[model samples]
Target: MAERASDVVPSSAATSHSDRGRMNIGQVLDVLRPDFGGITIPKIRFLEDKGLIKPERTPAGYRKFSVADVERLRYILRMQRDHYLPLKVIGEHLEAIDRGLEPPPIEAVVPTVPTVALNSDGLPSAESFARRSDVRLSRRELIKIAEISEELLAQLEQFGLISPRPGTGHYDTDALVIAQTARELADFGFEPRHLRAFKTAADREVGLVEQVVAPLKRGRDSAAQGRVADAVSEIAALSVRLHATLVKNGLHGA
Candidate 1:
């Protein structure tokens, strides 16, 4: 979500800035850094480019942000981090806020995946379907809930079966499911060593898709990158279906 204009000036930035109800972008960063750990200059600039925020420009051509700007950014960041909502949906939410209407709760934006069903071909709906804001668990939390020891987790990480989100030191729900499944497999005498085949197959599939999208991703434009992402996603979903079909065929001696 991009930052939106607001009338109420947050008190924190108001007292700090000596200028006319505005703080330079640096000060705004400092004020927001506590809540937004990954906030960067480029991200702020992108938000401005997206028309999420319209900071006042100084005569010296410096960007100056008001107290409302800070609060608006905070709101935008929270909506993104907590809800994983697409920017369009969040933009609508912000528009509601601008109109003095109470926006729907963030949960309203989450797509509810049905728990059970199979198509005529016996394929799952939305294979490999994990929502963007799926469960985020820390290392310790995952270890405890998945009933896996630290040693097993270390092996899983070593084998690339599971790893934390880059720089976040946390695993998503998919990692949790993988860990639990690995533990169940271990009960049947399967070790992490046996899982290397699965990992290798996954890496090969990923490489194939990366090859297809590499050229599309070369462009720096958002639309081009979006196309690359969409291609990767479609390929991943198909890969899941392929794997499931192959396993079913093997079990049926086809």
Candidate 2:
């Protein structure tokens, strides 16, 4: 597809800018090579063929890429490498940008870690850990982002290590974390079945916390609800720290 005439600067104007600002195909390669080691001239041409980018052409037909074109290529490469997005999806993003609309959010494809502050001892603070994330991922997205196979995800669901939201059928941030962690554990020969004990322990801790918070919830007052939230965060952090310490001591003794 041909680029819009307005998209290309006139040849007369091109010569007026500093030579460093405008780049030929080889110069574009040199600029992008440090960050994208695999980029090649043919790759750039392929993107043009797909109509994802359109560098201007000189009278002799040599491709003349503007700085904007180079940045557009960078965005395309980053989406492909970091998010595993296909060319079709990247094209949609570029179209959105061209139309002056915000690109669709990618949180579903790349779940963001919740912002959390740490304590003086380098452990996450209670309030920080309590911050809820609204990120929701489809089953396929979860598998791709976590780099796990369908079989592993099914096994995780079977063993109760990760699950979708109750009704929406979308996995949340917690599920994403569990899935990624399970994938890493598989490297050490740990299977989903072996993680059942962890689920059981977590349930026990949750139950204990619920018992303490139940009274505050019963009050149903705004102040009571606030207290309940604070209590849960504090208790959860303490429980995690205690669990970690016990495991460390046991490993040292062994």
Candidate 3:
């Protein structure tokens, strides 16, 4: 027999009314339906079945959802609707949160280069270069979004031009940018092998920046750390501008 919504008790005599801020299945729907019009009891139950959520059960088998549970459901739904992330990926994010580790970044549904990366002059500023993006993409997602073939991605990985986050098996915004740039360069008959030089040059530039900031970073004060960050950002931005200007002149001379 199908269980009616009324069968679930929000607060029974056995369960203290003030025991906790718990909501029955019907109330849960009311709270979530505003944002998730399509959310149904079965859908919530399905999530529970998938181990994405765990709501307490009353002695009579009524489901009781807590505030935290509702928030978790909201997050899961938003990730699905906004980013098209798979349940497995969402589960991984929840697991990371539970373990007190930072989860992989969630890219905006419509992917684009971050506006913060550019200044009014149409060049990257120190703040832009210093700002870290919070975009993460799975292998397949990166390939499709970057419009690159699997073989090409493998080549990029081999050349160390792009890589996934250390332990997350997900690509960050830097990887996405590199992939897109490589694809565009491929039009000029440039392969990943040719890009290795750029990677080498980038590493050298990074080493220079690190040397400049090493002394500032040694200071234990917060102000010292702030200065270190500012120095790295400013120097990195300048290095990029210099590299771009040199390349432009070289191209014109060639």
lDDT of 3 by residue, 188-232 (tens): 999999999999999999999999899888898879978988899
| Model with the higher TM-score, candidate 1 or 3 | 3
Record all residue pairs in model 2 with backbone atoms less than 3 Å apart, i.e. clashing.
none
- lDDT of candidate 3? 0.78
Pitting candidate 2 against candidate 3, the one with the higher TM-score is: 3
Estimate every model's Cα lDDT from 0 to 1.
0.73, 0.77, 0.78
How high a TM-score does candidate 2 get?
0.56
Cα lDDT, model 1, residue 91: 73
TM-score attained by model 1 = 0.49
- Top-scoring candidate (TM-score): 3
lDDT digits (tens) for residues 1-254 of candidate 1: 33323333565545566355678888888888887899999999988888888898988989988777777777778778977867788776666565433455554532211123445676534434423533456677678768899999999999889999888887766687789999999999999989999999989988887888888888977699667666776777787789988998999996
**Residue range with the least summed lDDT across 10 consecutive positions in model 1:** 109-118
TM-score of each: 0.49, 0.56, 0.64
Worst 10 contiguous positions by lDDT, candidate 2: 1-10
Candidate 3: worst-modelled 10 consecutive residues by lDDT? 1-10
Q: Give residue 166's error in model 3 in angstroms.
A: 1.7
